[model samples]
Target chain A: MPREITGFSNPLIKRVRSLRDKKHRRREGLFLAEGLRILAEAEEAGFLPEMLFYARESAEHPIVRRLVRATEAAGGDVIETIPDILHKLSGKENPQTVIGVYPERIVPLSALDRSSADIWIVAQSLRDPGNLGTILRTGDAVGAGGLILIDDCVDPFSVEAVRASMGALFTQTIATARWDEFVSWLRAGPGQLIGTSLNTDQDYQMPTYQRPCFLLVGNESQGLPTTYEKDCDILVKIPMLGKADSLNAAVATAVMAYELLNQRRAR
Target chain B: MPREITGFSNPLIKRVRSLRDKKHRRREGLFLAEGLRILAEAEEAGFLPEMLFYARESAEHPIVRRLVRATEAAGGDVIETIPDILHKLSGKENPQTVIGVYPERIVPLSALDRSSADIWIVAQSLRDPGNLGTILRTGDAVGAGGLILIDDCVDPFSVEAVRASMGALFTQTIATARWDEFVSWLRAGPGQLIGTSLNTDQDYQMPTYQRPCFLLVGNESQGLPTTYEKDCDILVKIPMLGKADSLNAAVATAVMAYELLNQRRAR
Candidate 1:
């Protein structure tokens, strides 16, 4: 039988709530994956939670019962809590039935399995969590192998990013690298480094993206710096027919990624 | 000389702040465009603001100075306020140096210039303001004719949507229609109605999109209803290689739009 808790002051509840903040999430090396979909994805990806929290009504749902059983089978704790606890954990009026605490799964760039993925995304100093998450989801949609976060990008495990990813966080490989570290890894390349910028006249669709390609994208406001663009094997730009100067970073990435996928599929 | 307002209680300031809410925006027939980039895009699109507000420090900047002069020249009010007033209007701790109030510009489907565009996007019951805005931006990037909003979509003039558009709101033609009304208009066709859904196994890129096509997309949660899909000339799905069941509505729209652009460009 699962433990039942009602108090807001419970130690476990406090710890789970603390996962909402990046500092605490990083320090503890754990993040929360909420809702039935994310929990299911985590389970399918072989990432059972350390703790599973659910409301009484949610636990009554057939899917929640199955998830609870799965968590128990994976040696995870299953706890039943009041709606108020679920609301606190999720910060939504109608919180989802399930929230799981899982360890942060990011690996260093060197540890990434380069053998399987033909394309990789390297995002530099990305500031928005939603864009980072959307890129992850888009990367997964096109079957990109992994994501490399270069420099100080937003936390991929952050709540907003996780939500925007729509559960791709559990399905995709994420790697973090410093500028020097990323550059050296690319130089040891199995593929080309393609960067997108506004300075170039070349249409993004013009390129025949080399396999195992690492597509490097820049920050939202300031695009790729000259130093960074200089390092790329080729630079491309998505044509802008309107007055708006640039596509939103995530949208631009998606256009390029899908174009690459389209090219490969055609061949 | 432009008027300087010192108090937060000013009626004009209150009215500008109220633009944040949909009710107030609709009631007054106005919305806001903030920051230098958006303001510049609006100016370039010939959608000048009715009133311009700026901080004292912002007024000292070259672009702000030019914008203030341009607003005054264009028969619009140019007001200077304290940073707090700008903050309240923007709902950001660090507000942009400038904010502008502009009238809502949506037109009915009957008024859209159908002959000018070879492609358009019809978003059915889109709920997210940000996604709608991104779609607008993406549509503009691909040189699509316009956007059609079906029943109960979020207000395109909402602050979040307008901001997400990054000024594409001014450049793109937006029309609203009911489901029945849209069907009748499609029957009086200038284009083919292409619907995208996961229910179909036909890959999205496989089709040679018909020109002047209307790409119909469903709501975020409940995708295109069978009834809606039944009316489309062709139904297609973006392939999913990973665990995510569906792409974000905006991302899916971008992928389809760009694929069409790529096909056209190749020809």
Candidate 2:
């Protein structure tokens, strides 16, 4: 039988709610992954949660039941809770069937196997967690090797980002480092560093994306700064046929990523 | 000299704030287009605002000044207001320099010129204004003919959607109709109807998008219903390489739209 959590004051409940904040998430080295789908993806990625919680209504769900059983089999505790408790934890009016507290797994820059993966995405100072999450989903869709965060990008494990990722968070390897450090790492790596700029007349589709290529995109409003733009091996521009100045950062990244994949796949 | 309005209680101020709601937007037959970039795009597309408001700080901006001058020359009121009023109008802490009240222009299905354009997009009951907005932007990016919103969908003129569109709202021709009505129109049209479905094993890339193509996509959760799926000329699937079951609605639309464009462009 799984343990039942009745009160919001429960130490475990406090911990789960605290995971909403970046400070607590980083300090605890754990993040909340909500919904049965996300938890299932995590499990499939061999990333079972440290703790699992499910509502009574959700506990009756077959996937939730299986998740509970699997969690138990994996030496993890499953906590049955009221819907209100879950609603509070998730900050959603209608919370998901299940939520998991998973350990943070950060892949270091040095450990990245650059030679094995064809394309890598490097984002600089990305502000929106939703954009970051969508980028992760796009990256996974295009079979990109991994993602690297330069400078102060949004937290990938945030609820908004994780939800946006649609379980791509579990599949894609994510690394974070300072701008200078990433520049050094890129210099040492075996890949052409490609960047996007509106000033460049060269069309994005014109390029032949060589293997182990690093496609770097800039922040949303300001775009690629001069500091980062100077380090890129090639700069390409997406043609703007309409009056809209630029595509959304995530959308631009997806367009470029898929184009690169399409080129490689066709060859 | 542009009239300066100081009070938040001003009738114009109330009118501007009320534009945030769809009810007001529809009743007034007008919508809010904030930011200099969006306003510029609106002007460039020959969709001048009926009224324009600019903050003192933003008034000094060269583009804002140009917009103000152009609005005045076009026999439109160019009102100078405090930053707080502009912020309230935009619902942003740091509002853009200018906000414009533009008359709503809804293109009817009958008015659509399908013969002149090769690609079109049809979205069925899309709920997320953000996703719909992004799709509109993407559709514009790929040089699609226009967008058709089927059945009950979020208001494309809503601030959330308009902002996400990044001025593409001014460029793309948006049409709305009941699903049944859309089907009748589709049967009468010249385009091939294409859809994405998980049940379909055919890769999306395999198809040569026929001219005057109607690329149909389902809603966020409940994709195209069986009824609608049966109507599609081609049902294709974007491969999920990882655990993510589906891509974001806007991202999916973009990928498909761009792929179709790429195919045509290559030929």
Candidate 3:
């Protein structure tokens, strides 16, 4: 039988709630994922949460039981709590019945195998957690190897980002590196650095993406600096048919990624 | 000099702040848009805010000056206010320099010119304001005719949707209709309804999109219903290379929209 915690002041509950903060998440090297679907996805990806908390009301759910069994089998804690505690832990008005605290998986740049996949997503100075998460989903859909964050970007372990990822956080490998280091790594690898830029007259579709394509997107407001664009093997531009000047960063990345995927399929 | 309003209790201030609520906005048939950039985009698209409020500090900004002059020329009210009033109206910790109250523009289904563009975006039961706004931006980028909201969707006039649109709301035409009405409208026109679905074996890129294509996406949680998919001229699926089951709605829409755009460009 799993332990039941009725008190809001439980130490484990407090620690799990603290994971919502970046500083605490970083120090503990753990993050929170909510909802049964997301937790199931994480489990499917071979990740067993260190701590799994489910509402007592949901204790009888088949999926919840499976999760509880798997978690306990892995020497993880399984706790049954009331809705109030679940809500407090989730920080949501209508919180999910289940929430999990999982270890953060950050792959080093050196561990990334360039030849493992045909495409990789790279973002520089990305500020929005939602955009970052959406990009992860896109990367997974397009069969990209992973995401590489260049420079100061939002923490992928942040709750907002993890939630937005919709379980792609587990599906896609995430690595962080500075611009200089990323450039050096790319130079040493067999890859094509393709960037989306407004300065280029080259249409995005006009370029045939080479294998091991690295699709680089810039910051939301400034876009790629001129120097950064100059470093790209080829800079392509998505056409703007209407008065709006640009597509959202994540949207643009998906469009470009699909284009690359389609080109490969056509060949 | 523009009218100076110092008091937060001012009737105009209260009215403007109330526009944030859907009930109040619907009753007034007015919506609020913030930031100089978004407001300028509105102005360039031939929309002049009925009431323009700017912090006294931004009066010297050239774009703000242009906007002030344009509002005055259009016989719209121009008020100079403090940051506190701006903050209250926008509900942001740090608000934009200006806020605009404009009459809501809803293009009826009958008014859309299908032949005006090669592609059109259609969504059924979309609930997220951010997704709605991002779809509008995608539609504009691809040079689609407009966005047609089917069934009961979130109000496009909401501040969250408008902000997420990043000014594309002014560039793209938005229409709302029930599913029956939308089906009737498309059937009467020279349009091919292409839907994204997991039920179809046809890859999204396999089909050559016909001109005046109506790309239909379904609700975020429940994709296009089986009956809805059956109604589509053709159903297509984006290939998922990774373990994730699906892509974000906005991301999927963008990927599909760009594919249609690219097919046209290729032709």
lDDT of 2 by residue, A180-223 (tens): 88888878857899999987898888988888899998999899
Residue range A1-267, candidate 1, lDDT tens digits: 788988999998998898999999999999988888878877887788889999987777977898889888878899999989989988878787888888999999778767687778999999989899899999888899889998889999998888888788988899999988888977875878999987788888777888878889899989888899989889999886766778888988988888778778889
Candidate 2: segments with Cα more than 4 A from true spot: A9-11, A75-77
Which residue runs does candidate 3 get wrong by more than 4 Å?
none
> What is the DockQ ranking, best to worst?
3, 1, 2
- Assess the local accuracy of residue B236 in candidate 3 as a C-alpha lDDT between 0 and 100: 94
Clashing pairs in 3: none
DockQ for all models? 0.76, 0.64, 0.85
TM-score of chain A in every predicted structure: 0.97, 0.97, 0.98
TM per candidate comes to 0.97, 0.94, 0.98
- Per residue, candidate 2 scores C-alpha lDDT tens digits across B139-182 of 88888878999977889999999989988888889898887888
Number of the candidate with higher DockQ, 2 or 3: 3
Comparing only chain B with the true structure, the TM-scores of all models are 0.97, 0.97, 0.98
Score candidate 2 by lDDT: 0.87
